[model samples]
Target: MGASIPPPPPVITRSSDMDPHTLEQLRAVKEMLTAQEEEAQGLRDLNRDLRERLEDCETKIKKLNEQNDEYAEKEKVLSHRVAEKVRNNKQMSVVMEEYERTIS
Candidate 1:
């Protein structure tokens, strides 16, 4: 195999050697980056607020769901009791009819 050629040394340019136009472009890029950082911080704050609100909403939803379950159970119990009362009333009416017929 042929020996690998070494890479050329990187040409180093000092900040003082940078042309005025290149320096201006660099300064513009730095300003843009600073603005982006500020915008990112604002987004982070907004995200934190939204997260807190979402958590609160979730908690409220959970509480409401639990309350709904409790109410459903209570309704079921009430419905069962009402049905039992209706059946008892029907039986009592049948008994009364039989008694009246015997009396006649």
Candidate 2:
């Protein structure tokens, strides 16, 4: 087999050697990247704020649900008491009617 050839030397290029158009393109690319980074940072901040608001809303909803449950239980108890009073009133009316009949 033939001997392997040595690799070519590395081409070192200085910034001064780079053409003006190429340098302008690089600067434009850098500016675009900076703008994109700023936009991304703003989005991240907005996302954090939205997350905080969502957490607050969820907490409020949980508290409201608990309060609703307590109110429902109180309403049920009150309804039962009202029903008991109605039954007692009906019984008293029946006894009063019997007494009136006996007097008549």
Candidate 3:
């Protein structure tokens, strides 16, 4: 004849065996988890705001760079004009000196 398998042990319940300290610790853990969830949500909102601000700053910087290029082009044109004026003035001074010497 084959041997039979043993049965599993039965569970025992006792309402009087509950520990008060363990219950209090469980409640404290739940409160901590709730607080952590709220803090995480706040951080997410702040990160989104910062990302939007960074995009705005990037757009402003691009516009300023375009304006700076326009100003640089204008400056180059003015510089060329000033150089021509200086050349003309030097030539006129030499001509005046020659005239004075001839007249003396």
**Top of the candidates by TM-score:** 2
TM-score versus the correct structure, for each prediction:
0.72, 0.81, 0.69
Q: Write the per-residue lDDT of candidate 2 for residues 1-93, one digit (tens) a residue.
A: 999999997664876877899889989999999999999999999999999999999999999999999999999999999999999999999
C-alpha lDDT (0 to 100) for residue 23 of candidate 1:
90
lDDT (0-100) at residue 47 of candidate 1? 100
Off by over 4 Å in 1: 1-19
Clashes of each: 0, 0, 0
What residue pairs clash in candidate 1, if any at all? none
Worst 10 residues of 2 by lDDT: 9-18
Task: Name the lDDT value of residue 31 in candidate 1.
Answer: 100
- Deviating ranges (above 4 Å) for candidate 3: 1-22
User: How would you encode candidate 3's per-residue C-alpha lDDT over 1-104 as one tens digit per residue?
Assistant: 88998898653365345478866876799899999999999999999999999999999999999999999999999999999999999999999999999999
Query: Judged by lDDT, which candidate is best?
Result: 1
Kindly report which residue stretches of model 2 are placed more than 4 angstroms away from their true locations once superposed: 1-15
